[model samples]
Structures are given as C-alpha cells and as structure tokens.
Target: MRVMAFDYGTKRIGVAVTDPLQIIATGLDTVHPNQIIDFLKRYMQTEQIERFVVGEPKQMDNTPSQSAIHVKGFVNLLKKTFPDVPIEMLDERFTSKMASATIAQSGMGKKARQSKALVDNISAVILLQGWMSKP
Candidate 1:
C-alpha cells in the first residue's frame, strides 16, 4: 500500500502519492474540490492507498489559520466518503511559498512560474515528502 497526500484548497486540491514501497512521493493531479472523492475512487481502483495526509493550514504563531476551517470541512467529508482509510494532518504554513520558490529557482519560464496549478501540485509533493520524512 502507498501513502497519499493532499494540499487542500477551496478551489483546487493538489494530490500526491508514494510508491508502493513507501519510497518517494510524486505529484499526482489537481482536482476540483467537489470531485476529490470520485477522483480517489478512481485512483483506488488501480492503487492501494494506505492512508491520506492532508496539509493543515496554520498561522505563524502555530494556531489554525482561516483556511483550517475549510480544510476541516474537507477532512470531515473525506472521512465520511472513505471510512476505511485513515487520515493524517501535517503543518502546511510555507508550502506554497516553498513551491513558488522552487519553481522560480527551477528556471521554468515566466508563465510557468505563475501557474497556480503547478504551484499546488508541487505543494502537494512537498506536503507528502514532509510527512514521509517526519520523525
């Protein structure tokens, strides 16, 4: 089984998954908020997902940010949709910033740097990597 990760947003959600060996994480896709459950159902048909790791939006002072409310709702919905799969939350304060920086430093074109979907996809990769490396 593999671990899947989500960078949840109000509009688009970025997804990532680990290899079956539990190795590195790779960016999967960006799905609409309302379509995530169907998306996971499709994914689970071909892959065995052990758990889900969701980015928990937080403020600089370690308090849940405004986005956390939305994330919590998403989590609740996810749990209800797939009661068999366990979910985990990881702090996601600067993931977007880091992904932006990574894209800018990666020498991608100016247009690519401004792509929100690209940033979100990379953010999900970062979120999953963070979870996998957690001690």
Candidate 2:
C-alpha cells in the first residue's frame, strides 16, 4: 500500500508519496494551505494512497508548539475529509534544517535554497523517509 506524507505549515503544505511497496518516499510538491484538501482529494483519486502521515511539529524539548496546533487542525481536516484512510503523526523536529543541508550539499544555488516551497517539500520527503524506516 502507498502512503502519503504531509509537512503542514502555516503558509504551505509539503507533500510526499511512498512507492507502491511503501519502501521509498519521494518529494511531490508544496501547495497553498487552502488548497491542501482539494489537492489531496485529487491525488487520492489518481493514486492508490492508503494512509496519510502528517508531521507533528514540536519544540526541541518535545513540548507542543504553536505549529503543532496548526498541524493538529490540518490533521483533523484530513480525518473529516477522508475518514477511511488512517492518519498518523510523526515527530518533525530537525527535518527542515536537514532538508536545507541536503539541498546545500546538492550544489543548488542560493536562489533555489531561498524557495520555501522547495525546502518544505524536501522536508516532507525526509519526514516520510524517517517514518518508513521505523520498525
């Protein structure tokens, strides 16, 4: 079964999808906050996505942060829209920084790194990879 992962942010929602075997995750794209539900609905209709894994933002100390609340709200919306698909939240602490580092190491120009949507989508890929690696 394939799984879709989301990195929910105030401005953008990053999307990533796993292979049909659920072994690999690839960055898809970042969509505007208001378009997430519609994007997911269209994507689900095209692909056989069976699960959604949303990144749960928290502070370094593991306490809930303001971003966590936003993520929770997004998840709730997901539940209401796709009640049958299971949704899980995975801790997303350093995924953004990690994604930036990955892009830096890839030799991308500074202008590319400045694109928040690109970083967000890459972070979503990292979040999904981490979840896929879990036992």
Report, for every candidate in turn, its global Cα lDDT versus the true structure: 0.94, 0.91
Error of 2 at 121 (Å): 0.2
Q: What digit string (tens of lDDT, one per residue) describes model 1 on residues 1-135? A: 999999999999999999999889999999999899999999899999999999999999999999899999999998998899999999998999999999999999999999999999999999999999999
Best by lDDT: 1
**For candidate 2, which ten residues in a row score worst on lDDT?**
37-46
Whole-model lDDT, model 1? 0.94
For every model shown, what is its TM-score relative to the native structure?
Answer: 0.97, 0.97
Query: What is the Cα-based lDDT of residue 51 in candidate 1?
Result: 97
Against the true structure, whose TM-score is highest? Answer: 1
Candidate 2 per-residue lDDT, tens place, 25-106, comes to 9999999999988888888777888899999888988999888888888889988989999998999999999999999999
